[model samples]
Target: MAAAAADEADDSWMIAQEWMVWWDRPSWYVTIVNTRIDSIHRRKREENEENERVEGERREKKRAGTRGEQGEGESRRTTGDRATWRRQVKRRR
Candidate 1:
């Protein structure tokens, strides 16, 4: 793109004074600047869409036990559990 711009500037410019650059002129520079800004905007929109998709997946995983399973704790024993442990310990001794 710069090459094309340089070629166009070279063909159109007629420098009568020394050390003058027509490619640096606002008319030519703004076109390149606008093209770059359009590219940045496109990239930002793609990133935003990707982020939203990933966030939704994460939310679903948490709800369905794929991420963090809810109520997944060890069970508490009833009062009668002591009789079982006592019988086992007595056999071992």
Candidate 2:
């Protein structure tokens, strides 16, 4: 049991030394910082894309509202007034 305990302790010490050597490397710190920066940039890009998608949907709804509920090639102003329709078209322009 004593010999087994000694072997375990030796193995742990070797692992600790290897960890210390890795931690002392400059590339380890640079890699950590670069990873964090990349994560931040990716998150911001996703947020911007989601915002743009929502804005596009809002604009489409606004256009549809202005056009009324009429189908394609159908006039929304069904009052048969030609002068009124012309005035409406001019206002839109």
Candidate 3:
């Protein structure tokens, strides 16, 4: 009975050591996740700034143009709109 108890204790100790070894290492998954999140945040910030600048320009154009159509409409259009319009035009022809 005492031998069996010793074996169980030994096994538990080995498991604890292994767990500690595994847990102590630097995790690539965590690093990758952090890097990806930071990259996404940076990209979103740049996109938001660009959008704000474009919106400011659009407002200025609206105020300045007497006929309300003198701005770069195609250049100011969103990427999705341009792609969708291209696809539709291609299909129509």
Candidate 4:
């Protein structure tokens, strides 16, 4: 008798689950597809933004390095002494 009752309870639960799935079946496919597409687009946008940020940082660093090298060359030409160059380097630090 207890086994029979448990079986009946399980059947009822399965019927309820089936009913819920049937009710949502009409729009479930479209909803799932749209959700997946939206997630893909969001990830792609985030990745592109990250790449752009890294590229911008790389460009800035490159420009700063070029300017520093140019300035050092000009200073060395104008000063024409190792001691003066050392002092300038210390001052920059």
Candidate 5:
């Protein structure tokens, strides 16, 4: 029965009755405080998730931007190498 009740209380890590008995507080106080703490944890989790998602998107955009810049550099390097090779061929001829 305890295990079954525990499973049903999955929404909170803290138990209201446990808090009431442990704190020697009133039932209403235990219920309100436990519910408040659970809500705070939930809000924090949501904020962290949102922050991570935004940071991931920012990093992805930065990486894509760098890839475009590097592509231009690679093409310029190739052109420079080809130009140098052409000059050498002309001199030989």
Candidate 6:
């Protein structure tokens, strides 16, 4: 008979009774606080992702810009070398 009574009062019932005793505040207040905390965490994660994307774009642009400058310099130097060689050949003839 005692075992049967104990079985009737299950763990879920005990937990609910304990929770009710501790959280005497309104349910809406708890919900609002939890929602605000979740929102803050979500916003922070989004901002961090955006910052990372922006940083990646900036680095890519810098690398491409330097490569373009080097290519232009090399092309100009090659053209100048060719012109100087042609002039030397004409003078030798």
Best by TM-score: 5
Clashes of each: 0, 0, 0, 0, 0, 0
In model 2, which residue pairs have backbone atoms overlapping below 3 Å? Answer: none
| Model 1: worst 10 consecutive residues (lDDT sum) | 66-75
* Model 5 pairs in collision: none
Poorest 10 consecutive residues of model 4 by lDDT? 71-80
Candidate-wise lDDT, in order: 0.66, 0.79, 0.78, 0.75, 0.72, 0.75
Instruction: Judge candidate 6 against the unseen true structure and give its global Cα lDDT, from 0 to 1.
Output: 0.75
What is the per-residue lDDT of model 5 for residues 1-93, given as tens digits with 9 covering 90 to 100?
Answer: 999888878635557666557689777988998999999999999999999999997766655544444432233334456668779999999
Question: In candidate 2, where is summed lDDT lowest over 10 consecutive residues?
Answer: 71-80
Cα deviation at 87, candidate 5, in Å, is: 31
lDDT of 2: 0.79
lDDT of 6 at 56: 95
Off by over 4 Å in 6: 1-22, 69-93
Q: Give model 1 RMSD, 1 decimal.
A: 17.2
lDDT of 3 by residue, 1-93 (tens): 999999999999999998898677689966886899999999999999999999998877755453334565424455565678889999999
Regions of candidate 1 where Cα sits further than 4 Å from its true position: 1-24, 66-93
Task: Name the candidate, 1 or 4, with the larger lDDT value.
Answer: 4
lDDT for predicted candidate 3 compared with the true structure: 0.78
User: Whose lDDT is higher: candidate 5's or candidate 6's?
Assistant: 6
Deviation of model 5 at 83, angstroms: 24
RMSD of every candidate to native, in Å, equals 17.2, 16.0, 13.8, 13.7, 14.1, 17.6
What's the TM-score of every candidate structure?
0.42, 0.47, 0.43, 0.46, 0.50, 0.45
Deviation in Å, model 6, residue 3 alpha carbon: 52
lDDT of 2 by residue, 11-60 (tens): 99999998898778799786997899999999999999999999897766
* Poorest lDDT segment (10 consecutive residues) of candidate 3: 66-75
